[model samples]
Target: MATGSVKIDVHHITRVEGHGNIVVDVKNGQLKQCDLEIPETPRFFEAMLRGRPYMESSHITSRICGICAIGHATASLRATEKALGVEPSAQTVLLRKLNFHGEMLDSHILHAYMLVAPDLLGAPSVVPLAKAAPDVVLRALRMKKLAGDLCAAICGRHTHPIAMTVGGFTHFPSKADLEALRQRLIEARADVDATVELFQKLKIPAFERDTEYIALSKPDEYCFIDGVIKSTDGGSWPVEQYRQVTNETCVKHSSAKRTRHQRESYMVGALARVNVNFDLLHPKAKSAAGALGLKPKCVNPYMNTVAQVIEIAHCVEDSIQLCDVLLSRGVTWEEPVAPARLSGEGVGACDVPRGTLFHNYVIQDGLVSGANCIIPTGQNLNNIEADMRALVPAILDRRPEEITLSLEMLVRAYDPCISCSTHMLDVKFV
Candidate 1:
């Protein structure tokens, strides 16, 4: 290990959804501190939910994150429906799944091409890459547009969807619109192959640290919007017991909470889902994984982006099948399912683009009295720190600038939704 004294302080890390800082210190060839500090103040979405009409929970909570709005809406609706005893129709389930596919595609494509690609290609951001590789940028934009249009066709818009609600959707896409979307998804396969090729050529950092992986899983399907919370560490818990699984505790360094379960830290996201439900992936996605050299039980956090690309392929193929099913069955107008009762407590969970998201609500006399939501990023903070601690020691021989880039890449690999903004890395040698 070649180290004297090195310090890296990245103020407001770029390309993520929220604000966070990376702080590292080393002295006399020994690591002293490595931390991913989250300074963004709490938004208090759960507190905001109390005293609101039960019907409004989904809409209000959807405002939590534009990237995860559909996921929030779906989870919020499930909690409300379960508390109120409303069971959506089969058609509703299919439509909601299709809407979810749109979001998965939208978010994954944005991250893979726009956010993370810069690091892999050694550019500052996608803007420079546009001039360097125009076709790749155009491909990303095309796929993103298709994802957005798909969401609009189903949920009345991608970000903070307006159609989705507690019992069911307030709007539905026409057959013509769905058929057009299906055609586009079919056409997008070429781009999907191109994506696989792009990632295959770019090398991911060779690093592995075994950690517990968690996600929503079903025995028969690649569960996304619903299922039991399962962990690779050897147990499954219903979403109701998420508190036990998460074991969230406050940390002095972060305004956001840190979580641990079955270990000091557990990971959730595309890699977790892939490890937990590899068999359930669509056949084409499995093939993509093979080509990309990703397999179940992968521990490299850097490979999460590859897992995301694999999921993108899965979303496209499965969405086409869902479209075919809807077109074949012929959607019919149906009233939104009404609650059988007004007072009960329920929890809902979904494997969102980021990871497993949980929303719990207690409804009393048609008003929400209590609420709890655990975001993926909150669940991941501790794990990110754990990774940083492990990584810094191993790379102590590298120059300070190279070490700084590696740490930045490590954080960006997790794709933490801390906030949206980029800032410079400030290093101090003491």
Candidate 2:
């Protein structure tokens, strides 16, 4: 163990996305402290959303994060729909789910094979992975492209697609387009299988801490689109009751609001989803989990990469099934009836690739009176800091560079969409 004091600071973490910092303090062989600071200026998305047309909420909120634009779009639409008491047709619902699956698969692959894998493999970036292991990288990119293709088929374009609207879609994909997508996803199953196997083979550092994992859980199905907010600690409430279960408090140390449950910090994201909905996963996902020796209750945060890969496979399978249904029954493009009266409040929550995303809205005179969005990255900020506090003590004796690398690796595992939480902007470390 080293004697004196060592302070390691990582400001403006690069490569992945968003703005944040990780600081570790050590003294006299004991870890003194750690802080995960979110200096990314808040855009006051909720504050800015006041008085916009209710119908435009989805479009406006989708700009929160470029990487997860579709996720934000879907969550915002779900909340707006709830507030207006409007439900889209069955076909619209299925299409929305397909869009979400594509976004998840796309984001997960980017994180697993591109952003996160380089750290584990001691490479600088995925570019090198492409050069060194061209075949592996190509396969991974193909799977990622499939995800993009899925999104394009349903939403019209892969990035920030504009087809989604409140009540129902402005247009629906043709039957032939849907069938082609289904066929492509079916062919990519082997790639997903390989990705899952690759994740299982990677050596994940053991950093386990008992945390309250929060996610969405429905009674009959694995929740991606809708469900009640649930936690591993046996605490749950309806989506509307989220403000009661989780409290957001601001600290002088960071720009991002810290979230706590029962006065103790909790975590939400892929790990939370998998732990809360292990049984709800598609049978193939469950089988993959089993093959990887993952239990229903996974505690190690690093294992989230595996969970994400499993989810990608599940999403592909689910999309295929949904396409099969659409082919048999067909779809209709119908706009929902504009609300006869539009003065009310509603809340919505969905499980994003990162975690549970909550949106609340107040609609008056057919316009958005007010809006509040609680993103997954903001929810996990406090928990990430807590984990750092616990981890620094274990690795304080190592070289400063090694310690810094380890800490950064831990943060990347979350695959945070920081830009979404705080409007899109460059993250600065200081």
Candidate 3:
């Protein structure tokens, strides 16, 4: 048995969506190597779009990740439209933003209740939590179900949406449907407040690193649907100039590519969004952030989970407001925006639940000639490794079990969808 050194190989971390290995080796307290290895094979989502009709591109790419199906679909449609130079109507933009909020609520609820709750409560899984804290679990299930209904009302399905298209939705939700969803969200406000209270009492670990943060930002609001890519390092770039900032390079250990922006590693997702666009958050969400002691330039990665909590407040309230507007305007049956020409190229950047997602496409003669997607988890992989590099040595004196749990919790904090990041590294627009 090795006594003076620590050797840990946590193969396939639990609770996260896909396979990854966390390998750390320390010999006589001298750090040897620590790597968060992405061993899963790549899924070539972009290549699949080749030769497909531009209309079908959104449908095919929406299958990229079940949790981020709306994000993928939204980004894909935006790219398709930009290529064809057809601007969506004001109603279309409103409904699409609402559609994304539904996904944010649904996906965040799962991460908070189903995944992170077990770790926080010292339970093995949500199954045990159902017995240990049935009320808490029930609230989550109710909220999740309601959120799913919101998405389905707008997009025709939750997991893989069908109604949303490149130019606009096939049809808008009925007045009755919007009214019912508004009522459900009103009823769920108490549940969201309960969640805030829960997070307020839980003890999150203390760890901080001043990493560069990036997200999409636009005028007068938090731009989830459309924006320029802005970095906290005081650099902002157009969506088309994404490659200049991403600087994505293939790595030996990760099937997912590593990325850097203005520094060695930068973070994305809720924390980055909060850090960059704190002023634009809904008042309730801003209040939640204030209560949680999460201010701008917050360096602690663990607080990413807290940022997510704050966003739940925002998503619910914003969705309600969106619903009110849609109801007042009245739902209307509209056809998808027709393309001006078959040959064009465009790129889209949008804020998802996790972070900024990029989709670039070239439509040649009514078919998608090429495509590329940049995933949030892919951007965070290097940042997570950087955190581990700093963390392990500080906690080396602690028991092995404690160290292992801390690392796992750190990864869980990001709420990473690994399979979503398993996109191919080498992509060339045709």
TM-score of 2: 0.96
> What's the TM-score of every candidate structure?
0.97, 0.96, 0.97
What C-alpha lDDT values do all the predictions have?
A: 0.88, 0.80, 0.88
Which pairs of residues collide in model 1? Answer: 17-419, 17-420, 18-418, 18-419, 19-418, 19-419
Which stretches of model 2 miss by more than 4 angstroms? Answer: 1-3, 423-430
Clash number for model 3? Answer: 1
Whose lDDT is higher: candidate 2's or candidate 3's?
Answer: 3
Clash-forming residue pairs, model 3: 269-354
- Model 3, TM vs. native: 0.97
Please write out the lDDT profile of model 2 over residues 286-391, one tens digit for every residue. Answer: 8888877678578777778778878887888888998998888897767764664677888878788898888889998888888888988888878777877787
| Candidate 3 or 2, higher TM-score | 3
Instruction: Return the candidate ranking by TM-score, descending.
Output: 1, 3, 2
Candidate 1 accuracy as lDDT: 0.88
| Candidate 3 per-residue C-alpha lDDT over 252-305 given as tens digits, one digit per residue, 9 for 90 to 100 | 878999999889999999999999999999999999998888999899998998
Q: Enumerate residue pairs that collide in model 2.
A: 11-429, 12-429, 19-427, 269-354
